[model samples]
Target: MGAQEDAGFSTRQVHVGASTATASPRATPIYLTAGFTFSDLDESAAHFATGSGFGYSRTGNPTVHAVEERIASLEGGDQAILVSSGQAAVTVALLGLAGAGDHLVVSEHIYEGTRGLLLDNLARLGIETTFVDTSDLDAWRDAITPRTKALFAETLSNARNDVLDVAAVSAIGAERGIPLVVDSTFTTPYLLRPLEHGAAVVVHSASKFLAGQGAVLGGVIIDDGRFDAAASGHLFPHLAHSDRLGGPSYAEKYGRRARGQYLRESVAPRFGPSPSPLNAFLIGQGVETLSLRMERQSANALAVARWLEARPEVERVDYVGLPSHPHHALGRRYLTRGSGSVFTVTLRGGLDAARHVVQSVRLITHMTHLGDVRSLILHPQSTSHSGRTVAERELAGVFPGTVRLSIGIEDVDDLVADLDQALDSVASVATGGRRTDAGTRGSEREVVVL
Candidate 1:
C-alpha cells in the first residue's frame, strides 16, 4: 500500500490499473464522464502542463489506463497506449516514428487494412513503403534506404500464417539503428511477445484475440522503452530534438519511454483515436482469460488444419502448426506456444467451391472478422484482399479458392464435422451430387463440385 509494486501477468491483468482503489470496487470502474473535474485552476494547470492527471478522456481514462497497463505488463513493454482500433494503432505508431517523405520497409504479407494504410493513405501524405517477403532476409536488407525510418511486419501474418522471424529482422534493424515494429495481433502476448525478441515496438489489434469475444474494438502500442536517441539520433532526429513550442524534446523528457510518451501525449490525442471506457473495460475483461482461450483455440485450429490437409478436395492449408508449411520451422523457432487459431485453406475447385464452402457451413459463421469465440470463415479473395492486384493477392496467398478460417474454442470434432459438411456440399456441386469416396478415405466422405 505504501509503494507501487509489480505483479504477474494474470494478476496484473486483473488488478494493476485498478489498483488505485478509489471506491474499493473489485472490478475496474468505468469513468464514463468525458472530463475529470479538478479541485481548482492550479490543479488544472499542473495536469495540463505535466500531463499527470486524466483531464480529458481523449488523452486518457482510468479504465483505458488499466487495459494499457495490463497489456504492457503481459507484453513485457515499458508502456502502452490504447486506441480506438487496430487501424488507429498502426497509424499512430507509424506516424509517431515517421513523417512525410520517410520510408518504411514492411513485410509483403500483412493485414489488408495495414497494406491500404501504407500504400494508400500514408502514401498520399508522401510517406513511401517498400514491401519485402516475410522470409527473405536479403530482400529486407535491400529494401532499406536512407529515408527508411522503421521495419514493420506481422508476428504471425494474416490468413496465410506466415510466422515472422522477429529476432532476425530486429537484428537487422538494430544493425542499422532502425526500429523494428511488429503487429502481434495474431500471436497475442499469450502466444508470443515480440518485444522480448528484440522488436523495438509492438502493436496489436485488440479486437482480435485480445478482445476474445469480438464485443469490442481496441488497439495498443507498446514500446520496449529502450530507444536511445543518442544511439539512433540521426535516424530518429524528430524524437531527439524539440518539436513542441518550448518544451524539451520527448527523448530528453521521457528518456527510454520517449516514443511511447510521444504517442500517448501527441499522436494518439491529436489524431483522436480514443477508445471508449466501456470498450476498454470489456477488452480488459477478455484479457483475463486470454491464455485459456488461446490454448483451446490453437488446439482446435491445429486439428482443423490436419483434417483439411487430409481432405481430397483441399488444395493446401496455410497453418504454421502444420509440418508441411514452409514456415513451420521458423514458427517453431519463434512461436513456442500454439501457432494461433487463424489460417487459410485453399480448395481445389476454385472460386465456386470456395463460395459453396462459405455458404454451406452451418456452425461456422461466414464473416470477415477473425479471432471470435465463435468459428468464422470467409473467402478472402473476394473480400479482404479484393482490392489488391492479382499478383499482390497471389503473393499474399489469397487465391481464388482460399477461404480464411478463424478457429474458436468449440469442440474440435464439432468444428471438423461442420467443415466436413461444407466440403461435402462443395463436392456435391462439383460432382453433380454424386457422392464419391474422395474426401472419405477413412471417416470423412468424398466432396466434389460439378
Candidate 2:
C-alpha cells in the first residue's frame, strides 16, 4: 500500500507494511536469508548501483523493511530505517546530519546513554553539542549557531518526565533552517506524532513501548520530508555532496526518505548495526498491539502516580498527569490523552530510603529498563544517571532519593498496593530509630515521585 493509504495511527499500526495480507502462519514471516539473488547480471548491477530493493540482509531485509515502513507510517513520515538498537538509530541519525566540526542543540534531560554518546563519543569525533532546557525556547534560540546542523530532544525525557515543547523547538529549527529531531520513545506514536507538531524527524527506541513486551531491541528513524536539505546544504554536506562520491544525493534519490537512505547507505552499513530479521519480526508483532498496551499502561501509570502523590512518605511525583508537576501544563498542551507510562518519584528519607523501596518491591522488577508489560523500577541517581557527577545529576532533576517507575498492564489496585507496601517499608526503616541524614529529618519528610 502507498504511504497515504496508511492514514490513522492505529490503522497504520495494525495494517501498514505487511508483505502478506494473510500468511499461512498468520504472522509476518521472518526472511532469515543473508542475501537475495538478482534475476540476472543487468538486474544485479542496477540494484547495486541504485541501492533499490532488498540487496542484502545487512543492507536491507524484507522483515526489517516491513517494520521500518510500519513505523514510518505510524509517525506520519515519508520513510524510515530500522537499526539493531536505539543507540544505533540515534547515532546514525545524528551523524547523518552533523559531523566533524559541527554542533547539535539538545535537551539536557535526555537518556544518559544518549548524553554520553553526544558528549563523550561525538566530542571525540569532533562533533560538539550543547544541552539546553527543552522547555525554554530562548535557550534553544541562543544555543543555535551557524554550525548547528540539527535540534534534538525527547518528546518526554526519561526519569525526569520533562515534556518538551515540540512546536517551539520546531519553530526554532525552521528559523535556523535546521532539522528538528525528537526521540518519541517515551510517548510513542500512538500517543504523540512529533512530525505533526513541525518536527522534521522522529526517532524511537522500539526496545521500549513500541515493542510492547521488551522482547526485542530495535530502533527506527522516520523522516517527515518537510525540511529542505538542499537549502541548508552547507550545514549538511552529506546530503549536499553525494554527487562527489558518485552516490545519489539524499534529497535527489530518497527525497522524503533522504535521512533514512543516508542512515541505510553511509551510516548503518559502515557501523554494521543492522537488526536481525527475527528481531524485526518480533518487533512487528509487538507493534500490532501497541495501541492496546499503551492505553492500559497509560492508565496504570496515572493511577500509580496519584497513589504515590497522596502518600506522606513521598516527597514529589513527576508524572505529567499530576497537577503538582511543573510540566503539567506543558503535558496537557502536548500530551493530549495521557501523560505516559514512565515517571519518577522521590522519597522523603533520601538515597537510603530509595534503595529500601527498590529492594522491598515484590511485584515491580528492580531493573534499569522501562516501558515493559511488567512494571519495572530503578534508582536513577544510583543507576541510570550514576555516570553523571552529583552536580550534574541535580541539574538534571535527579535526586538521591528519586525512584523511576515504568507502570505496566497490571491491575491498578495491585500496583498501588505494591507501591504502598514499598513506601510503608521505607517508613518503617526510617522510623526504626536510625536517625541518619539518609533516613530521617526534623520535620515530616515529603517524598515526591514523578
Instruction: Choose the strongest candidate by TM-score.
Output: 1
Candidate 1 stretches greater than 4 Å from native = 1-22, 430-450
Please write out the lDDT profile of model 2 over residues 1-450, one tens digit for every residue. Answer: 787484888888876775547546666779998998777888889888887777799988988888888888888988888988888889988988888889999999899999999989999999999989878889999999999989999998776688888988898888868989999999999889999999988888989998878788998888786647656766776776676859667777766566667777888888888899999998998899999999999999998899888988877788889998889998998888688899988887876688788888899998767789999998887678878766667767677777889999999899988888877767566434443543322332233232
State model 2's lDDT: 0.83
Candidate 2, after superposition: displacement of residue 98 in Å? 0.9
For all predicted structures, in order, the TM-scores are: 0.90, 0.89
| lDDT, candidate 1, 240-307, per-residue tens | 88875776888888898888898888899999999999999999999999999999999999999999
Residue 432 of model 1 has an lDDT of 35
